[model samples]
Target: RKQRKEAPDDARIRRFEDRISEGKFYLSLSSTKNDPRLMQALRGRLNESAEALGKNVAKDSELRRDVYEKMKALERSLAKAKRMQQEEECFSSKKLHASIVSTESQLRSTRKQASYLTQLAAKTIPRGLHCLALRLSTEYFALNSSRRNIRNEPPKVDDDDDRLLFHYALFSDNVLAAAVVVNSTVTHAKDPWKHVFHVVTDGLNYGSMKMWFLSNPPGRARIDVANVEDLAWLNASYSPVLRQLTSRKTIDYYYYGTHDRGARADPNAKYRNPKYLSIMNHLRFYLPEIFPELDKILFLDDDVVVQKDLTPLWSVDLNGKVVGAVETCGEKFHRFDHYLNFSNPLIAKSFDPRACGWAFGMNVFDLREWRRQNITRIYHRWQELNEERLLWKLGTLPPGLLTFWNRSFALEKSWHVLGLGYDAKTSTRDIERAAVIHYNGNAKPWLEIGIAKFRSYWTKYVDYDQRYLRDCNVT
Candidate 1:
């Protein structure tokens, strides 16, 4: 057979087929196994083409370029496989992380729900139970007081007799009724409390206190102080009225006689009336002696309103400090002329008045420390001398400013805020940040500005017939 001068490529391919039959492909598997099988096949084809170049170099060049392109395509396929595997691993990890976060959120929500329920259960005690408890307590206090009387001595320290005696009187039927109603409303309608809300009002208008209890009832208990003396006597006595005022709620209340007397270490200021602060020289003097263990207590003037939740203020630590009253005018002296006798150290020391802002007119107090330091003498001495700075001698001045400085406790602005009296165009939005709104100054809310920003507070509780507040006609 005349083997025509066939192309060299045809001859090389025929040889390759013969070599594969003799296992040359198996040799590729051993030498280039790590490379893809496709790469091995291309390399074998290139070797065939190179041999063919001996016969035709043009064909060898074309085959080499084709082999390079095929190798690049195979490398791309391997890279894609690696990227797909990596993406799958990343996707699995993210899904696991999301599941963990969801579980944590659920746990947190469950804990808060449990806490709310626990607080709710605590305040669910019946009203009848509280009345019974108070009745029993009253009998106990009367017995103890009688026993002390029979012994020809007053109850002393470490004696439950005196302690229970005070509590029993303070937690009377009227106080309990108010306290019970207040404690019954537990949820904050909007927020929650770690501890119960405690409110103190002069029972001036059940409106302010009542609205507070209604709007923000205690998660735990309520304490009120209401005066019980004859209207005429109440208006006249200082200690009794104060005692009544403090005793309106069972939690903690204090009422002093409007015209009566309290323990007088030194009588400097003659007139001390609850209605007229000018009449009361240093009545807050008795606060510590009466309740010595309290770290702080809020003092509020009657005409105020509580608009939002007060829990934030109650929760503050006060950092073992006293919050001073407001410095309405930037005067160093309460009165300019009062600076003449700045010789008394008390006067000298206080002449540079700390400009403590208005007492938590609605304020928080550090009562235990206040009583420990014996503020009564601090206040009374100021009152004794005729030329004594009358402004310095006043009850509110000494305890409100002097004690705060001596204790070295820092001052914090209270949410317990005072309203800057009335005006024809006063904007309550200005004082919205205030916790307790005091309707201070002569521009009375109930009398003149009947529909002030917080008027609903007063109108809700004032029984026009029974309540005789001054300036009822002003509004």
Candidate 2:
């Protein structure tokens, strides 16, 4: 058995030796040059010879020594060839890796440039479009053309009669938004003629606002339009609160100066339009003085669209509370700190930051009770404190919140659905179910920034066919 095994091993060794000799001749022919195929073949032969010698030469000491010497020589040649090939491969790999890194760097730079251009376009394009729309609307309003009267005269109402009145102090640059509020209110009301709307606006918009209502009156609903300037009792000189609100210092404080280092401190700081802090927004505080004869009234913000009859709000017993408004404690963003600067010690101690806040858009004010509790003084005191020390940063609601803190009654959240203008994540179902939808943020539904889905809720009441709306492309 040993002889038979040795015989096969000896033959294998001889074959490998012949192959190695053939490889050596080929390699020597081009000794200075490298050939991958020639090297691979020689390496294969060396491996075969080593395996054969291990099995066959073990039985013969002399043969084993001679084969081992030949095998060592073959291995040295194979190692040299492999080392040269590896060096070439290493050089090629380095070039490939460098090329990949360079390509990646170029890609990153291109992406950043693209991102910058995209941001620039986003900011400028919308602003340009807004400016153009404003110019067209201004020209449209300038045309002094007579529109067909839908109602001959305002529906007469007895001054002493105890009828439901929806009072709205609408101070807007967009007359379309004001008209839509009236249209939506009367359209959705069960008794359109019985419902009365008291609309107040600024001096500049009075002519266009009155003209629109005269032509497109909402089914005999008593619409009264008054300019804030014409209200003889609403003099700024007489009211310190009004004077402070309209002052340049107050504007700066609310808009840019509220930050730690003012406007320069934070590049992304939020600033309100001076118009948002206007006397019109603060006018709700003086509801008792404005409508002295009226006992209770539902005050609607111009940004709101009434989907359901607000007459039911009259029966919602405020339980002797002066103001009845929807509690906003359910949302984290609606918390006290969102509006009031609690960093100040007076504000920090006065109210609970976690306490439930209320909505001002749809409120039922008990004017008689309001006067009885002297709520206006409380409101004015806070306003004065805010002016003196910057108690709260921006809105009228903060002072309203402080004044009506313990005195106000909490109404149902469904009565007023806020965040339509700002929060895009608000549930569609909740918006549809709400009796009143308020676009309380900068994105009023009349503006292009308003969410497209919510705009339909406000715009459905608009008369797109009207000559004024058509001329300005308001539709």
Candidate 3:
């Protein structure tokens, strides 16, 4: 009994010590009372369970660290992506803002330019035939130069040269009252013929108008002047060319007018005076008489200056072609829209640069063909229609007939460009290329200032006289 008990107590003591180490003293007696093999087996199982728990705890801690690190990385990546997206958005916004600003500036500039042009057109171009004729007369003098050579001579220079000079002279001026006259002046002090330029008053434009047949004044490219009043007559009458055309040809001013009838008793009906239209109409009628051998003739308005020599232009062999007019860059007196109303079986077609706006005021025509085709028939019919519409009112036709010829004519843009009633400044490049300078406005170089390239022409015209600037208001 003592021996068995001693062993049991020793085993019990060992188990107690094990329970103490495990922090569970209550489990020592219970474990010791259980079957020895069973207890031992239970202890073995508990050890295995403890090992599994330790592995599970370690794995859990490792998993937590990995998840935390992964989350932090994802957050940083998201923030970076957001920052990059914001930068792109900001850049896009800036570009859009810039584009809008640029577009607005362009639109404003365009609007301003359009407004200025519109105002000018409405206010300045209403002078009708008196102004029209004046302009034409002035341009004639400006384009044709006085030369020692005879008219029958072969054009010395390229005809285009004269044409270009005309363009430069007409375009160089700043306003209707201020038009430039570009010319070559050879003089003692300087070769005034080399590249002399000056401003010409509209009043003194008679020299250009009759240059086709006029003689130059002594030692000058102009005509002799007695007084300002006789300028127009002297230029038109005292030409060497007039002597040549003695019996067969004649030159005179064509006139047309309408009287008020009792039918349309409205006194205010004359608000838009039809007199201006009459001048063109009368011109159309008298053109045949002035240039009798031909069915068509050229009609030039004043305020044009020629840069190139015109001898070549007259020498151009037109054959059977009708070179009508040049295409204008700015405002057009006879645009397509205006021609639409005049459309008919004879003139229904749209404008063609080859045909319409080709010869312009400076024209070359096939007279025989024009008469055969009844070219003036349309004008006659229109005049009749106008008479029927208002018995008392003056009926006048529009210049839109030029557009009707667009299909049956030839035009040279490089050779001719109308000023469209104002002095439009151009660069030297433009001047070099231009053929005829047409001044379609009232403010001429001799009368006004601030026009490009016109001052030189004005000075040339006035160079001969100490008091040559009588008619013009030079600034």
Candidate 4:
């Protein structure tokens, strides 16, 4: 072959190949053989390798760049493989997490619906109780008081006995509920004869209430039922509650406002019970005036059932305190701010936000002290301040918390265990040992929405086999 002028890049590559053939950096198994045959075989392979390098490695001083490019390509391949493996591993985990989140959302929605429905059911009056009320009222109105002769009459429960007796003032419109209160009290009383109940009810339920307690006389526990409206002095002029009842703003807020404007509805809308508008709910404020003769009285809510002897409550020295109650707040949220609107300048200035709140279900009131402190007057002042509903919307608790703020004597928790109605997790041991178990929430024992476990605690106290209950089919 004719000799060709070699390019400088080609010459450099040739030198590098010659070095490798001489066993310099590159490896070749044929290097050990120094025979002519071996030399000839290597010559053919080296020419082919030199040609391959021309196509792959860039010409001249670009060798370093070529090496780095190859390394980067290898690293990219390794990284791609790792990413694929990770994606495969995480695919199932991602799916499971999304499913769990979806299920939790559904559970929350379902629980909210269930809770709202239960509250509504609790508010409804059952047919059996309605029938019982009607039957009792009919029987009560048909006969005269002389012919009626209701047991536990006036002679034993005269005004003179008020100071000496263990008095309970229960204000309720529900006749059966009132009966249960009296029954439980009388049954649990250490001395039933020493206990006297001043039950005040509205005009609609007056006859029926009087009749039920009369027909089912609570042994020797004297229950004197009276009409709340019949108290002429308790009208819009004297009582602040009655005065609030006459307020056009109060009427609109309770009657016309927040009446179920769906979608725009409040989650706590059910808690704004219309019963708060009733006089009996407010009548609890007027315990001293309701029974002016009584010096000390244990106030009982109709929803409560007496578990232990309440006579000790009468002797619980209030230590100059106007009211004695089980403090509902500790680290929990039942505080002054929870009831009153702290947004109002007047409320914020008047009270401590974290001040402990007390239960009203089972309370001991030193009516003499109440009179001395003018607690009712103070209560009326707060009511008037909140007449426009600035301080609070809920009736019973806010004004009460304000009225009896520092005036309360903290009783032991064992005396009253509450939350049986709404909170399912209320301790069974606490309920059992409780002197009084109160169904303070919407799930009253009388309602269909009542918790089954707690319902029995209330039902066991009730004598369902009684004549009137059996007649009206009140189970």
| Candidate that scores best on TM-score | 4
lDDT of 3 by residue, 1-475 (tens): 4665334324533432343234222124343224464345434444443333333343333333343343343334334444545666787799999999999999988886765454444334333323433544565545535542223333234534533221111111122222223232123213222221222223344343333123222132322111133334323233222231231211111011113332333322222232232222244333333334433333434355555554344445555554455654244444444433433433344333222232244454555555655555544454444432221133222333431343244455656655523545544466457665554443444433225555453345433321222223222
Ranking by TM-score: 4, 2, 3, 1
Mind giving the per-residue lDDT tens digits that candidate 1 earns over 1-475? 9888756745533443344333334334322344465445545554553353344334433344454443444334434434544565687789989989999999988876764453343324344333334443344345534332211122233433322211211211222333422332222213332222233223232233333233333443323333232123323233332333333221111123222233333222122223333222223444454345545544444455554444444444555454434443332334323422445554566446334334435444556555656555554444334222234332344444544554433334345444445343444564566555565544444343234655654454433332112222211
For model 2, how does the per-residue alpha-carbon lDDT over 287-392 read when each residue is reduced to its tens digit?
A: 8787787788878877889888777887888899999999988887778888788888998998898878888888888888999999888887787777654676
TM-score of each: 0.39, 0.68, 0.40, 0.77
Cα-based RMSD of the predictions, in order?
A: 23.9, 9.7, 22.9, 13.1
True lDDT of residue 381, candidate 2: 77
Model 3 TM-score is 0.40
Error of 2 at 152 (Å): 6.8
Judged by lDDT, which candidate is best?
4
Full-model lDDT for every candidate: 0.40, 0.70, 0.38, 0.77
- Model 1: how far residue 270 lies from native, Å: 17
Model 3 score (lDDT): 0.38
